[model samples]
Target: MASEFISSDIVSILLFMSPGFLTIALVGKLYGIAIEMEQFEKTVWSLIASIPIGIMFVYLNEINSIDSFLNCFLVHPLRSTFEIIVFSLILALLVSLIIQHKYLENLSMKLIHNKDDGFQTDRTVWDRFMQKNIGKAAIVETHNSVYKGWLSANSSRKEKREIVLDSPVIVYVHENGNTEDFPYGKQIILFGEDIKSITILEED
Candidate 1:
């Protein structure tokens, strides 16, 4: 009789703990996406928020299976616990996906807007220029007007600082109260006024 009681108690504990364990596993999977601890920590907090749901599942499964020994045949407590855990995992995953998607969307919007009024440049101009021409490339020319090598703006920062343009490409142009293309790696000499524009010539 004592052995039977021990078995039942073990089964009961397993049945109750499964849902919370499943929740932690699901959250851990999402945290593996990026190593941002802030985001991962927030996700763990969200998992904790679902503990009440897990407790409810555990209570329901235990109560439903308490009566008969043959209850294990028709209504398996462990199986019911797993089912509830799976449901909670799905819900938590969906919520995490939605939050991640929103964050990406907001970041994309900020990149496109480029809200520095001094430049007055918008996304449409940026898109049009990039479509017609490849991304900003630093063209180095010798003082004798000879073409040197081309360097892409996306290149490493160390590479960018090493670039030098000859006299022709290194002219000083005024903003003239008009929006200009904000090219990458182009040096802007902002006098007393703030930097208002940038333009990069198409690489031939």
Candidate 2:
């Protein structure tokens, strides 16, 4: 009988406690994109953090009492659910903030941002320039050729190795500074594998 009771308690903890901690991390996201971490690692860390917080929540609420003792599922099932959710949310937000500031910066390693502005992100000089010059004309210089076009702002992802251009006019720059647009379609895609530099052209 004692072994059965202990097994039931263990099952209850596994079923409720595991998902309870996961809910906390999801709530902490505030409907934003979740951080790029391994799902297994995230869950493990969340559960480890949540255990003590869950205990504190139970102690504070005093939900466990003789009244609910007959309910072998948990000391106070309904109230415990509420406690888990609230505590998980609080801990989730706290841990997310710690990881954002203490562990990783905005997106890239070589980026600068204004702390006062929530959306002010400044990465490398080239990236900042591209962001500011979106829809404007620019020249993408590669190892063997150049492509001129309006910079597509959405071309770059944090770790992507390629970029996109709209209304592209492929051209080659001569040593004497002469340029002639090549016969090609309006759209051009360039890979960082061969790109040497990006120059924002003054002409429209």
Candidate 3:
């Protein structure tokens, strides 16, 4: 009787542990996909953030069914499967939400604030630069200026292109700031370190 009781307790512990483990694994997988798609190099960081939350969920569930928890393992395999599926779905949703929020936060910083230009919210400067130069390519005349060029960043040779501003570059210009024209015979480059503000100028 003693041996049987010990075996049953062990089985119950395994059953309880299984659901949580499944939840973590499923969430982790979804997070991994999000990381790849978003190119966010913080998988380990996200996983670390989630651990405490997972533990809290497990503790809460255990507290609700302290007595017959172990018996849940032996009820039926289908029931166990169903429970795990539901838990995994919830975990996936949570992870996706976390990932999305982080992505938006990072994206927000890349936006330029130019309220006087009639933009209500901060707009991504790099995106606007691209839009402005869509038909006529703009060359980085200097760290602070862009000029019309025959070849835009898209068509330029890798060697001729500025490594910085690889993504859309956001420019922030102060209200009533001076807009400078792109000088001739100079390449434009917005080094990651040199970005102070973004300004849109009308061609004179």
Candidate 4:
């Protein structure tokens, strides 16, 4: 009977943490954040977040305290759980927007004395360049050829490093110093290993 009671308590604690996990996932998607953490670490962080969320919900709903909320949750599980779920969704979305817009970061920069202009939010140079110049006309230079087309998509992985170009025309220079252009109607996928340099063309 004691073992069964402990198991039930464990289950209840896990169930209470579900909203936190859901909020984390929602925030990641909406904010475009890459949550790089192990499952155990994520669970611990979620549990920490869940406690505050529950407290906030209790206060907002005019509940007496955490004890009252827990009692209501136990007595009316379905309705209370649904309300928590809805509140979590809204909270997650708001948090995601805050991260995405970098409002806090900007505020900090203004308040703090930081004059270094080298700071960038993107993880990599490729990401920064692509964010500003995606879908523009570009020239891709390979070892033996040059490809001119509109830049489509690029992979985020540094190891893979693949890029796609739309309606590319490959220019090959022969041994005779004659250049021949072969226009491909379909898109071309180029590996980073084969690419020598990429230049984004400006608006005419």
The number of the candidate with the highest lDDT is: 4
Q: Could you tell which candidate, 1 or 4, scores higher by TM-score?
A: 4
For candidate 1, list the clashing residue pairs, or say none. 181-198
Over 90-179, each residue of candidate 1 has an lDDT whose tens digit, in order, gives: 765765676577875676556656666444423454344433433444333333322212323222212222222222234323578543
lDDT of 4 at 107: 76
lDDT of all predictions, in order shown? Answer: 0.47, 0.65, 0.48, 0.78
Assess every candidate by TM-score.
Answer: 0.31, 0.53, 0.34, 0.60
lDDT: the better of candidates 2 and 4: 4
Q: Model 4 clash pairs?
A: none
126-177 in candidate 2: lDDT tens per residue?
5666677887888888888778887775444466556778888779668999
Ranking by TM-score: 4, 2, 3, 1
In terms of lDDT, the poorest run of 10 residues in model 1 is 188-197
Candidate 2 accuracy as TM-score: 0.53
lDDT of 4 at 20: 88
| Candidate 1 displacement at residue 182 in angstroms | 29
- State how far residue 102 of model 1 sits from its true place (Å): 11
Encode model 4's per-residue lDDT on 44-78: one tens digit a residue.
87887687677766776577743555567788888
Of 2 and 3, the candidate ranking higher by TM-score? 2
Overall local distance difference test of candidate 2? 0.65
Q: Model 1: runs farther than 4 Å from truth? A: 34-51, 58-82, 94-204
Deviation (Å) of 86 in candidate 2: 5.5
Report the Cα lDDT for residue 162, model 2. 67
Give the clash count for model 1.
Answer: 1
Q: How many pairs in model 3 have backbone atoms within 3 A of each other, for residues 3 or more apart or on separate chains, i.e. clashes? A: 7
Q: How much is 105 displaced in model 2, in angstroms? A: 11
